[model samples]
Target: MKKQNQKAWFFVLPVLLLVAFNALIPMMTVVNYSVQETFGNNLFFWEGLGWFEKLLRSERFHAALGRQFMFTGMILAIEVPLGVIIALSMPRSGFWVPVCLVLMALPMLIPWNVVGAMWNIFTLPDIGLLGYLMNHVLGIDYNMTQDPFAAWATIIVMDVWHWTSLVVLLSYAGLVSIPEAYYQAARIDGASNWSVFRHIQLPKMKQVLTIAILLRFMDSFNIYTEPFVLTGGGPGNATTLLSIDLVKIALGQFDLGPAAAMSLIYFVITLFVSWLFYTLMTKDDE
Candidate 1:
């Protein structure tokens, strides 16, 4: 048997060290703050688990977390199916293939903050295009700044517009990689379009779909900038997701200890749910 080469380890060591330096240092700092209270001037008092206990009992935390779950769930429900459908409709070959791909990728290429700013301007009631059309032309009472439902709808639609492209691109990649033989066999068997999709295309796309679900789940769960810029967590706390709430506690209220504790809890919940998603999605492979 040939010996394993060890030289490649040296090449990767610097990157590993850099990652650890960045991640571990901040994590350790958070851990310290989580268990301690600060009264400024770098003075910290031992608080033990007080902050965590307080956070678990806070109604604000519960509401924010609930909103976060709602947002993520809605995002997944809308984007996943919509993306798959768009991907299936895309041209599989020739000149239109590149054109379709470039269009699909355009939304994702825009900066996150810019997307939020663009939507904010685009939805202004009197002057914005969508708002003017909805309120004036279509005669709909639509104002995100004054209405909770409108705010939520605007954010959800904004997110779908911004991110469904990711799911579409991933799904399209999976679709394109499927062997042409599968389609030919389905045709020979007189498979209906629905039957072809359900039986062959869906099964073949499982791996990429798993990836899409996980990525969307994590991103939506942790989303901050767009909603913050678009709604500022709403006309009220109607759209305040967990990340926004955490930032409010940390910076808005200057509550370092509770913020740190909440961050740790948020981190744990994300990890646990992600693990659950991975396990359920891949269980059949085992």
Candidate 2:
């Protein structure tokens, strides 16, 4: 018993130490900053929960938070069902499977900054293929920089194009893992394609769907790069997301106290919603 316990500690200790060094320390520092105010020249004062109270009352924070939630909600609604449909349509076996998988994975391999930059260039009104086609070929006034709705649409479309592949890949993995016997049984019972998918594939893919939704939600909620690069949160704060606003406060205006407080609130909101998602998703599993 003593030997087993010692071996278990040996395996777990490294990971625990790594977590402490990497995550815990940085988190503690943020927590400390969130509750304090600092002036230049190394002066610090304990403000307690003053920052938090101010954040809760700030209309700017409220607007940004609402917009962030709207973006996240739209992303999940669009990506989840679309990914499921695409996954279900993909061939289970054949020469095309690897080809499809590789193609799907390609977008995910690109660096995030590159993805943002690419979209930024690709949406240029005069030079970009999409911009040219939309403006000239379709005979429509479509410039994301000028139109708020256009900017929002472009951002949503860009995100879907970039990240939908993640959901596709995860759902595909779940679909493949489903035993062949289940399909065979469904076929013997004369189940239609819809019935097979509804009764069999959907149920089997639940866990992966949960994981994919959670990942996409958190990522989209905290999204800062693509939209930032594409829009600069510009056209007069038309796309000023919480992250963009947070950065504006932290670095642009150099308000560390308020920024730290906002960041702490951001972290708390993410944690709470993530917990809510996990509970709802896995409640049925239990």
- Give the candidate number with the greatest lDDT: 1
- Please, what is the TM-score per model? 0.95, 0.93
Tell me the TM-score of model 2: 0.93
Worst 10 residues of 1 by lDDT: 19-28
lDDT of 2 by residue, 36-116 (tens): 897889788999999999999999999899989988899999999999999988999999999999999998888877887
Query: Could you say which candidate leads in TM-score?
Result: 1
Q: How does each model score on lDDT? A: 0.96, 0.90
Tens-digit lDDT track for model 1 on 1-286?
A: 9999999999999998998899988998999999999888999999999999999999999999999999999999999999999999999999999999999999999999999999999999999999999999999999999999999999999999999999999999999999999999999999999999999999989999999999999999999999999999988999999999999989999999999999999999999999999999999998
